[model samples]
Target chain A: MSETTILRTEQLKKSYEKGKYILNNFTFSIQKGEVVVIVGPSGCGKSTFLRCLNLLEPIDSGSIYLEEQLISAKDKNASKIREKIGMVFQSYDLFPHKTILDNLLLAPVKVQKRNKKEVEQEAEELNKKKIELDLEFRKEEFLSKTTIWWPETKGCNR
Target chain B: MRDMGISVLFQGNNFVRLLIGLLASLRIAAIAMALSVVFGVLVGMMMRSKHGWIRFLCRCYLEVVRIMPQLVLLFLVYFGAAKHLGIDMSGEVAAILVFTFWGAAEMGDLVRSSLISIPKHQYDSGYALGLTKWQVTVHIIIPQTVKRLLPSGVNLLTRMIKTTSLVVLIGVVEVVKVGKQIIDASRYTVPTSALWVYGAIFLLYFIICYPFSKLATSLERHRKEESV
Candidate 1:
């Protein structure tokens, strides 16, 4: 199936030191609406790959393309690139100072610059929808973006 | 029959005088602390600057404040600056300046450490939700940092209060200075007045600082419980 590739990487390499590559010559690609699971042993570069894809960690030698735009360049704005990708961390990184309702509306109202009233309304609807569906999903579902699942199946970390 | 130096406080208005002196100390500490907490947050934010030069400059400033004694700073601001540099500042003002500078450095370090204590994933989570860098810092990072900063910040305030005693050396006429005056006045009558006078001053300091120490502990415990 010739699906449109949403994310693509070519020869992605990450190293902690010289001649020691954690992610060595790793080539990966995922199409829009596609879900890919990466399984590996401890310290086998699985987390490194996800972090590199999200632009959290710099790649040593490789190129990353998000919808054909080169994101792994030296001059690319990391924060700007990161905005388009959602990463569910192994630990559900909830802002402890804010309430659950405020947490839901925070990014939409502040980051996206959407109307607070509108965003709150949307969040209210989403909260109701989740309840109606009776789906016991974790809070990570609200933190929408890239889907990187870990071992615990919810909040997995090493 | 009456206690040696303890009687001095009740002889006339010595106790009230000491209270007023304490208020003066607190007054300077309060103003300095308020300003330091403001500037300290800025300094702390700058400590995280991507530019090596900025971090180095902040580090130097922090080290300078940390290394030099507060008394030296007071002399520099009060005697040296006032005499040579032609800066007309009162003892109180000088004390405030010295304490503020020192407190800012201390609070700045506290802020930096608290900011660092936050897990990396908090920023990642914010960015992943399409938050800009500024938004991530303001919404995600800062709130958590504030929670972590509070306990230490309160402890800093208590230290600021205790350190205000040093202002007496620069002739600020604060609590310790008043204690000295009381001891000096009744030197012949209460030969051991220094012991009692200083003891009361110590009691006053303990009264003010103990609650803050408890508060810091409670805040830290509350944070630990919540974060877990």
Candidate 2:
């Protein structure tokens, strides 16, 4: 229960029926910048645990806190809590109608209310990085060219 | 001489009647398809709702539409509902209403399945991004649903074009009705013309439907190759 805790869950539980529990007495906490993974067997509820963390699934009983803000399982504001924790899927899940740049910029513009200019700058930087990575993958000699595009645009660096 | 003969046939009174009838049916089918797609997506989303009552209501709608034949449903709306409600409906209007009802139910099922086909991880990933439910739905869930649903919707559109012929039974003049008219007028003098007329009808349908089939398949293939 330190002041710097980014997420905390207490006694989180979920059950399909009254006497059976898929998750019972689950509790965990993670500080900001912490990288955590929950691994288990096929039906072991790792995904379910992630769903609970994101409040995508309703917990039968529990409380979750993000940055000192409490998230109710049934709260109308659950959506706001969802925006802070970006989760990359095993599948890329990129929008087909959108190009790669649009997919990356969608949440930032729509959810975070960031300006389109700022978002596009970030997108271009990411694209340049991707190109650099591709070049590196093909041959290591182009490592020097990685910073060639560096600082080409102000405020592009995340 | 052959071209002159064809132009003369085309300019005949019977040909004009057939042309008008076919256009009317196409108009009705197009409007109905548009309305049905909008209604269907909303209903389909509701069908997959977390709320039990919403899901039940949508399920009941699907069952009712499925159990009743499309022709019967058309008749009920055209004859029964119009009479009971004391509303005046033209044959074309009645056809649109009935087709829309049927289309909505069918489209809703397609949409629901498409929505479901989206990997569960997509939604979780959307949520992980701290997107609100509406944001996730609009930005993530719906876009994914569209990619999955478009192929099936195209298939449904092709079927709808063929189904528009059923409107002829309701006294709506469509391609088939016009073909029947040609056959009726020419049967005594030139019975062989019936086969050609029907063949023409098949060609017209193929022209309308073939592109949609190709589009559906290609889009599905492209989507498969795309990132999830």
Candidate 3:
């Protein structure tokens, strides 16, 4: 019930078939800027829980709220709600046809309808930061041959 | 040399008649291809519908089209349907309708297979990026689908162009029909003309289809290289 609560689920229940609930009476809440991880053994409802949260899987019972707004309502536009939430899978699911920069800019430009120039600039900045971070990591880890790595990272980093 | 049947090519207005017939065939194939692509993309998307009944219906259409020969489908549309419906349909219209129906099913299957071939993680990532299903489809899924479908789509188009000779069976004066007419006219005057006339028809078809087949192969090769 805290004012900072960004996501909340109340007695949510989900089941593929009759009688067996994969996610039964699960109630949880996350505060603003909080990083919440659901860790459990394989076959436990961890993935199902994330899928339900993203509205990829419909739940049998209960409700989910994002920013105190009822998002799991049947009539709610799931895609519009999804626009405010970003999920990253364990597997890097980048679009193979698109370049790394294009993969980063696609959602922002196409889905969010943000200005392509602005999104591209933001993506460029993010890419620079990533390269810088990688370069730093490489420098620290492999101090022997900085020259060999410079040419590879220079194209993007510079 | 003057008595040879190959003189049909040099015969007055006969060449023009063949050209007109070739144009007609091209027009039909072009119109059918455009309509087929539009309908095919829509039906293909529908085939992936979450509803069981909808998917079943699309599957049934796909199977029926695949199972029945194109010539039979042409007869059903031109002769059978027109007769039962009490409507008069022109040979050209019937040919277009038949080709469109056949092409749409082929294109739909292409779209469906290419869509399913896309990595599952791509959808997951699209959704995770806060994209709605529609957005994910438009921005992420469709672009990939189009890329994957292009080579096969080009190949389907060549197949359509080749199969369009069947339209001549229904009395549409396409290239093959014109060739037969030329041969019949010259049969007595130049008995050797049949070989040359039919050979010309073969060359015309080869000209139309060969480039497309090459394009499809190259596109497929490019796709393979990119995947690697």
Which residue segments of model 3 deviate by more than 4 Å? A135-158
Candidate 1 chain B: minimum summed lDDT over ten consecutive residues — where?
B1-10
For model 1, the stretches where C-alpha displacement exceeds 4 angstroms are: A1-3, A10-13, A18-28, A73-77, A115-158, B1-16, B46-67, B82-88, B182-200
Q: Name the best candidate (by TM-score).
A: 3
Question: What's the residue-level lDDT of B162 in candidate 2?
Answer: 84
RMSD of candidate 3 to the truth, in angstroms, is: 5.9
Per-residue accuracy of model 3 over A1-158 as CA lDDT, tens digit each: 99999889999999998999999999999998776667778878887888788887899999999999999999998777777765545444667877766776776677678898987776566555555566655643322122122221110100
How well is each residue in B79-159 modelled by candidate 2, as lDDT tens digits? 886679988687789888888888898999999998888777677656665676688788888877888888888888888
Q: What is the DockQ of each candidate?
A: 0.52, 0.48, 0.52
Model 3 chain A lowest lDDT segment of ten: A149-158
Model 3 lDDT at residue A139 = 45
The sequence of per-residue lDDT tens digits that candidate 1 reaches over residues A34-147 is: 667888887888788888888888889989998889999999987677667756667666667888677666755765577988767766665555653444455546443212
Runs in model 2 deviating more than 4 A are: A1-6, A9-51, A72-76, A88-99, A123-158, B1-8, B11-16, B52-57, B82-86, B185-193, B225-228
How close is every model to the real structure, measured as TM-score?
A: 0.79, 0.76, 0.86
Tens digits of per-residue lDDT for model 1, B44-101: 9999899999999999999999899888898888999878999888999998988899
State the TM-score of the second chain for every model.
0.94, 0.87, 0.95
- Report clashes for each candidate as comma-separated counts: 2, 6, 1
